[model samples]
Target: MAGVDEPECALPLDSRDVRCCCLLRSFSHFIVKNPTMNCSVQTPQIVGKDAKQHTLSPTCTGASVLGIKFSDGVIIAADMLVSYGSLARYLDVERISMVNDNTVMACSGDIADYQLLKRRVEEQTHTDSLLSDGFTLSPRALHSWITRVLYNRRSRMNPLWNTYIVGGLESDGKPFLGYCDLLGVSFSDDCLATGFGMYLALPLLRQRLEDQAGGDPRKLSKENAVQAITDGMRQLYYRDCRAFKTYQMAVVTSSGVEVRSPLQLETNWEIADYVAGYE
Candidate 1:
């Protein structure tokens, strides 16, 4: 748990209260101060008990989002482009998650907040109530829960630093694709993308997605799905400055979740091969 200062301890609790380090201490006091008070607190999902609210703006972060569909699995690709202020920095970031035996949670945001959300979602199923009630959370539901958390942070005037694209199986065990941004905005379907991907990759994907109901890549074989997602990455690299050929790819299917980091593209880069040059 994080610590709280005296000034924060004296403020009235409300929906707009941004959680600070001292807030935890105040929270601890709340429990002690009112043993019979009924309350529920929402914490970042994956981050452990010590996550803090660092005040930062949401935009100007160079994040990536891509969606791929094939005839056994679906692939979601995100560049490891972590930006420092306006300058694009860090290329070894992997935005995809292998959270469980069969799910992958991916994100584009404040790296710390992303990790926190991942941890919380993983811990949910381990609790006795969810297991005993025979009720399990689907990828869509988890996506929704994450959106609410982001909104809550925004309400407090302190928001998580990034957007997210969550991919996994649906309640019926079918492949699912969904996206949610820092504002808690969410949309699920056969294909979806956020950030630069919404412009670069979505146009190519919608052709296949609108073709049928089972257009998600998860319905296809892993190899085909991987190829589709890789092709999309290639386009994003050529167009999006924050993206490159090298990326992290993950496939979620009935078999399991597979993630390959630092995946690169082999391309012919002869400058004048296809164009007339000054010879």
Candidate 2:
């Protein structure tokens, strides 16, 4: 057996294949095939763990969004502030935006997530517009769509951290106000508030409606609705640490939607001298 010569292999095309075919195909059989020749061994590459794929923590976030329904239609307000943790990182950021000619939506949470949601909505709207049938997403339809999307993301455990308030005229020309949150929880309300506004501003509007409009949102005049939202935003600036004096509001009605540019709310620290906060 020691005197027996190895059988010939298929001729290799290059010098790289000089090590016999058996050894070239498998490093384990290299030394056995050719005792005098040497083969270079390569270590298998080890890939490291991948970085976190989804948004595990939100960096830029907005605060409360306040909405109210009046006899004319629905009005929603949000301060123009995007905070990085406790620091006010962005000023004059518009949290409330018009989704269509007749619909408006606002969010209180991670601005980036909301922006992504906005693009999705816009793409859907564009696709619908391509139909050219004069049909578009009504306030109710958009609200439902946003709810489903948020819920779907939540189910996947990578939620788009946003609490939304959508308002406008329904397909039937009736005023509609709907809310959706990060977990996809949603409901329609005559008056709605998210984030800090839920605790500080909601009660005020509810009380005002009860006292002036007999608890019926339709009884309130358009002026009253605007006044109520204004007051709520004002209160938020006074109380919500994340709230800014600068804000924006959108009014949706049978005619169309009007989103006011960023404006400063009139605030007063007059009572500051008389009151002291907890140490």
Candidate 3:
């Protein structure tokens, strides 16, 4: 009766009271059935939280970077194209850079992030120069430093979203090649590749290296190393969708790091002309 607002009934007091009690019970049941009408009760809210401070994904990414260590030095190669999804967004982008006279770095992933990483390396190099008494960072030392930096960023959940290959000669003029990724995972190898190069180019490199040096990358000659890396790049251009014919190559030796001219690979599409779906 308290919620119904019914007109007064002209009846005995006991009967009227009974009817009022019944009405009140009905009103209580209705409120329970439709809880939304009860403004006093609050509904619980749902929220999602994540530990990661930043989202990690590559945008406008470059493809594989290939590296090989040889008797004299190290050789690295990467294509010049940066792709945004399937679209080749940036052409002539240099993915290979000389960190110092003794080291070269090649990277695959977001070009913007790679540029930022390059700036950081340059800053570190400058700082080292200021502090050094005629002592510079060697290839091994630089690679170790970069590995620590990448690992720290990964631990913070803010990664560079790139895979890097550091190749050069150690202080003792020994060939050095190391690989690092966004997660700070790193290892040294006679041959290394990132992205599709790992799938398409790695086998070729391994086979060639084996033929030339019995799988001993350190035993490979400079000419054979260059040939292997160049052939791998050509194969990548032919097979990888994100790759292109134009690329940059770098060789690091006891003398210095040399980045050769941007070169183009010769591609043959003659097979496509005879395919079943030929136009």
Candidate 4:
């Protein structure tokens, strides 16, 4: 039994070692990390027989975005829809990441890439040396850092394979929201959308925005902004099967970040008049 514990090639990892493994996983790439050695062994970052070609895995897609603002507040909503190939295999793919206590990140891309981005962000949060005299990562600095990280990877021809929407309170404690895409193209707009949703869902959202002067939801309440999105989702549901009757939504404000699930609308008989004579 004692010999079994000390095998010829290696020793079994104890619970404490296993705990370190868990931490390493949460703070690392997909490969193993040897903490005692104070070194990291990166696994294959990405593996594909055809490295030069682009293949859509059942792992990506169903990426969507909906944002609303009311009373100087911003709310973002997305569905956890991960498709396997063209087939909508997984309807519950979560694209959101929590950065520290005040930020939320929504992602779209290869799931593996998304995971890598999350690990890198976690590692950043742990490093005390990176902070300025002020404690906590500055929102502007952090956003710029994230953008550069994504862009650098793309320049290496190994892009992170993700588009991102970052929402949270800034260092000055103001509500902020921004968007970054796979090519590292980033922009901060009062409203934004990505994926197929950009096509079908955005038009309706724009109309709503026009109702409030291109993203001014002060004319509307948080509840109404959310309702606008809910209504848009219902419209997309009838138009896009990839979108669900149930979706996830989030709101970011000076109050903090709030995310919800199974957010749905009552769609029983209200649209009968719209489809009455068509079909």
RMSD of each: 18.4, 7.2, 7.5, 19.4
Candidate 1: where is the Cα deviation over 4 Å? Answer: 1-62, 69-71, 86-88, 125-136, 208-223, 271-279
Candidate 2, 120-235: lDDT as tens digits = 99899899899999998898999999999999999998999999999999777789999999999999988999998999999999998988899998899888878888899999
Residues 12-32, candidate 1: write the lDDT tens digits: 654335465456767888899
lDDT of each: 0.69, 0.88, 0.86, 0.69
Q: Candidate 4: where are CA atoms >4 Å away?
A: 1-59, 128-134, 213-219, 268-279
Per-model clash counts, in order, read 26, 0, 1, 5
The all-Cα superposition gives candidate 4 an RMSD in Å to the true structure of 19.4
Better-scoring candidate (TM-score), 2 or 4: 2
lDDT agreement of model 4 with the native = 0.69
List the pairs of residues colliding in candidate 4: 57-85, 58-83, 58-84, 58-85, 80-93
Q: Give the distance in Å from residue 132's predicted Cα in candidate 1 to where it truly belongs.
A: 8.1
- Expressed as tens digits, the lDDT of each residue in 35-101 for candidate 3 is 8884486667565466335745667899999999888888999989999889998898889988889
For 1-279, candidate 4 gives per-residue lDDT tens digits of 232233255777777766766666566653345455555577885867875854334256556666655665667777766666667777666676667556777766677787877888778777743665456654455667779988987787667777777776676666666888777788776566777667887777778877765556556667667877787777767776666666788777776667887566567756656775555
lDDT score of model 2?
Answer: 0.88
